[model samples]
Target: MELRQLRYFVAIVDHGSLSRAARVLHIAQPALTQQVQQLEEELGAQLLHRSAQGVMSTDAGKTFYEHAQAILKQVEDARSAVAQSSDKPAGTVALGIPQSVSSALALPLLTAVREAYPEITLQLTEELSGTLIEQLKSGRINLAVLFDDGQLGAFASMPLVEEEMMFITRAGSQFAPKKKSIPLSRAVELPLILPGLQHGVRPRIENIVRAEGLSIGNVIDINSVAILKSALLADLGATILPVAPLLSEIEHGQMTAYPITGASISRTVTLCSSRNIPLTNAGHAVQRLVVSVASRLCVSGYWLGAKSLAKSESA
Candidate 1:
């Protein structure tokens, strides 16, 4: 119920033992146990499962822990925002980047943030686009680079770039497209390795294929970028995705990216933040920096097959 209780609960969960948390907090073990008991009673749920070794969070506790962490982060951000100067905003800003986007944008954005906002701590989380959406909605992350799937009306969004999907395969593989670009119908006929329906790009690909009276017949579902790359190298199957994820491989001549010709197979990359959660000064600074970085990357051709979207297209 209290801020101290939340802090204590988090500490206990992190340390995985009441005694260890008590030692870290410099509080008595009995008092720490009492605080947890009071919180559990108030919530009407047994948050932690006790054992002789230590303790573990129950299902209810796992859910509550996520909310507790978010609330604590907001509280810290509030304090920092009020005390920070406009010229040098100082606070922790959590930014989420999807795995594919991170391949091209993560390091550049991190370097930019460090150079420009030395006082602001930037925490970057590289996750699946689906997971990033949930984290952004829950206030776990301040901003995220997400693919615009026409269902992001609930969030404040700024279109960054439109990335063209490419049919990718290993350089010497039998499935490699001979031409500069392959038609969507021909590309889908290959033994394709693709993410499942939950992935942002997969649904788009499916819809496009469906509209063209085509269907992907043979496929292998893979979600991890590293594993997917290995599969491509091993000649498991070709995949249709933005070039960013396999940029290095393509550049090094280990992989080939053939643009889908028959249809406009692309996804808009958007910078999104929860409309309900107001950003801190540091968050705002990072948000602007992200847009700037994306533009620069597009202009310099550092991000392949990406076209920068005009500011007027923001949602």
Candidate 2:
């Protein structure tokens, strides 16, 4: 089958509807359907189960989707590899960053990369850590800053820092900071607003709480960090978060924070890339800059409640 046919099939699977995929591909719906039919005929398999709602990939379609994505990625990488042969690293580099890390590092990292590698185009994606990891595996992103719970052995990871999660609330609320540290048991008992289980930090906290033989109290689930902060300011409930996300609020006296005590609830941040896929020169440059910038931020105390993870300690 032609590469165009593969592209059409992949798009159909990704969007889950022929008309929607056709819209995204900017091609006529009939043409998209024709291409998909041609691919199915060539493969002698029904690729999708079409319905009014959307299309669901058949088992074979799922398998082909994975290979098609990899093939497309390799083709793109070949283009980037050749483009990086210049005196300076020059090409597009896609980097994924989780919401928590993006709060503190996104701006500074973007600025640093722009200043240092003007020719290397940077495409940054801010997403949940789990989503970022999935994208990394799918070859959608070249590199990512992810939370290391010591289970990501499949990736090439460089430990960046261990950031302490803190108890946070509105500055003048009843749950306002009363001490420099609050016990994990007590922290869980507070009226809490937290992200859903799909978020990286939420599951980590849940597991830690479970290990402590404690249950969270009065939780209000929120997925958006901005909305979470808004809920905090409205005196809705307290939250446990890394200081990086709410640093400006604490500094400006809009919120109060206390380090977690009784239990160590922290996440080890790491720079991760796929062990199976090699990075282009631009990708490597972006990874180095991320580590450098993160170190500088932690050392300067700009990334509060973070301790740098020495390079020798990377896994």
Candidate 3:
């Protein structure tokens, strides 16, 4: 019913115990419990269930907790908007990135942010695109680099780059690299290790393979990028992926990377944010820096098989 009630309810959910929450809020246990009871009565929903260990939110409580967090974040943003000086924006900006993208952009992005916006605290999370999307919708992350498969209607997105997927194998193997590219038929003939259908890249690869009228045989499903790379290094099977994660190996001759020619399977990387959540000054700064850094990497040849998306193409 009141802002303080919302705060108390959130604190209780976060600490998972009324007594712990009361201690954190510097209020009596009975007072905190009363506020939560009042909130539940006002909302006409039983929010939490108590247990010997601590407490757990009911399904309804979980949903309400998400909304409560978003509300509190908006309030904080509003206060910062009015109170902070114009010349220096100070706050935390959380950015989510997939593992493959993080291999290329993480350190560089961190350095750039540290130099340009020293007052802004940046939190970087490396997660799959699907996880990142959920986090974005729940207001856990301010921005993310996600693979675009035409499913992001709830977010505003800017096309960062279109990356060609490479068919990688151990160096000095039978599929020795001669040309810069290989046909889809040849790529499929080899034993393949790839991500499952749940992965963002897998569906794109499947669509391209299906369009080419080819079938993948002797396939191995690997979800973790580290394990997949290890499989390739151990001469297990060839895999198709962006080259960013393989740069070190390719340069060291530990592996060979060739473009998949006939299918030309690729994924477009998009910088995305929730359409309902307006960007703060810090968010805007980070977004701009990401675009700039990505463009520089692509243009300077640091990132292979990557084409910088024109500004005109971004939504």
Best by TM-score: 1
RMSD values for the candidates in order, in angstroms, are 2.3, 4.4, 3.4
Identify the runs in model 1 with alpha carbons over 4 angstroms from their true place: 310-315
Candidate 2's displacement at residue 56, Å, is 13
Off by over 4 Å in 2: 7-36, 40-70, 311-315
lDDT of 2 by residue, 1-315 (tens): 888888898898888899989999999999898888888999999999998899999999998897787678767777888767644787878899888788788998899889988988888999988888888888878898888777789899999989999899999888865777789888888899998887888888998999999999789998888898999999998999899988889999999988888888898899999999889887888888888888888988888999988642110
lDDT of each: 0.91, 0.86, 0.85
Give Cα distance to truth, residue 207, candidate 3, Å: 1.9
As a whole number from 0 to 100, the lDDT of residue 212 in candidate 2 is 95
Q: Order the candidates by lDDT, highest first.
A: 1, 2, 3
Assess candidate 3 and give its TM-score to the true structure.
0.84
Regions of candidate 3 where Cα sits further than 4 Å from its true position: 43-45, 170-181, 234-236, 249-254, 310-315
Please provide TM-scores, in order, for all candidate models, with all chains considered together.
0.96, 0.81, 0.84
